[model samples]
Target: MTIKLIAIGKTDDKELVKLIENYQKRLSHYIQFEFEIIPDLKKAKNLSESQQKQKEGDLILGKLNPSDVLILLDENGKQFDSVAFSQYLQKHMNSGIKQLVFVIGGPYGFSEDVYSRANGKLSLSKMTFSHQMIRLFAIEQLYRAFTILRNEPYHHR
Candidate 1:
């Protein structure tokens, strides 16, 4: 199955971009991975938080295919340790799906519409993280999950 990560806005920090790229390269060895950045909304300052989320949600939804399995990285979602997360990845891979899509929403988080359409929600941590930082964290974890599944030395229990 192809794994795709869709995040709102671009990473302005060069260092973070490099780190994300490194993990992306490593992930390519195990599975098909795609990273897509939805452009930041123009005149966002003029919109209310809810409105922004709606707009971002629309853009996110537009990128998804009907067959894609959608998962949202949300603060209130189920939390799993690395080993469990690896199992989660394995479960999806074994399901014979075409694509697994995980989305990192904008500042205000996902809209009601987005939440309604999601197949599942996952939390990386209870602690809050910047959207840009979360992109890096998600990719690294995905890479680690694949390595663990393959019994590679990259992930230490």
Candidate 2:
């Protein structure tokens, strides 16, 4: 199955960008993968948090195809170890899922509309992470998940 990661905003940190690229390259070795970024909203200073989420949600929803299984990276979502996450990936692949889409929402998180579109939610940690940092973490974890699936030496326990 193809896996796609969609996130809001750009990463300005050169180190983080480099690491994200590294993981993306490693991930491509295991699955059909793509990373798409939604540019941060313009004039966001004037919009209320709810308004911002609504506007961003529109763009987020627009990027999706009806058949894609969307998983949101949310603070209140399920938490899993790398091994479990790899098994999760394996289960979906075995189920004949086409494209597995994972989204990292903008500041103030996803709107109600965006929540409605998701098939599930995953939490990387209880601690909050910057959207840019989350991008790196998400991709790295995805790479690790595939490695664990293949019994590679990248992950222990």
Candidate 3:
């Protein structure tokens, strides 16, 4: 199965981009991984929070295929330790799905429609994180998960 990460906006920090790129390269060894960045909305200051989320949600939904399993990285979603997260990845891989899509929404978070269409939600931590930072975290975790699944030395107990 292909694992795709869709995040709003680009990473402006060169260091963070390098780190994300490193993990992306590492992740390519295990499974098909795609990282897509939805461009930041223009004139965002002119729109209300709800409108921004709605616009972002529309772009997110547009990237998805009908059979893709949508999972949102949300503050209120379920939390898992590293081992459990590896198991979660294994579970999805075993399920025979075409693509597993995880989304990191914009500053306002996901819209009602986005939430409604999601198969599940996941939280990396209870505390909030910047959207750009979360992109790095998510990609790193995905690479870590695959390494753990392969019994590699990358992850220590």
Q: What TM-score, over all chains together, does every model reach?
A: 0.98, 0.98, 0.98
Estimate, for each residue in 91-140, the C-alpha lDDT of model 2 and write its tens digit: 99998989999999998999999899899999999999899999999999
Backbone Cα, N, C clashes tallied per candidate:
0, 0, 0
Which residue pairs come into collision in candidate 2? Answer: none
What is the C-alpha lDDT profile of model 3 across 5-64, one tens digit per residue?
999999999999999999999899999999999999999999999999999999999999
Which of the two, 1 or 3, has more lDDT? 1
Q: How many backbone clashes does candidate 1 have?
A: 0
Candidate closest to the true structure, highest lDDT: 1
In candidate 1, position 34 carries an lDDT of: 99
Ranking 2 against 3 by TM-score, winner: 3
Give the higher-TM-score candidate: 1 or 2.
Answer: 1
Native-vs-model 1 lDDT? 0.97
Worst 10 residues of 3 by lDDT: 148-157
lDDT of each: 0.97, 0.94, 0.96
Model 3 clashing residue pairs (backbone): none
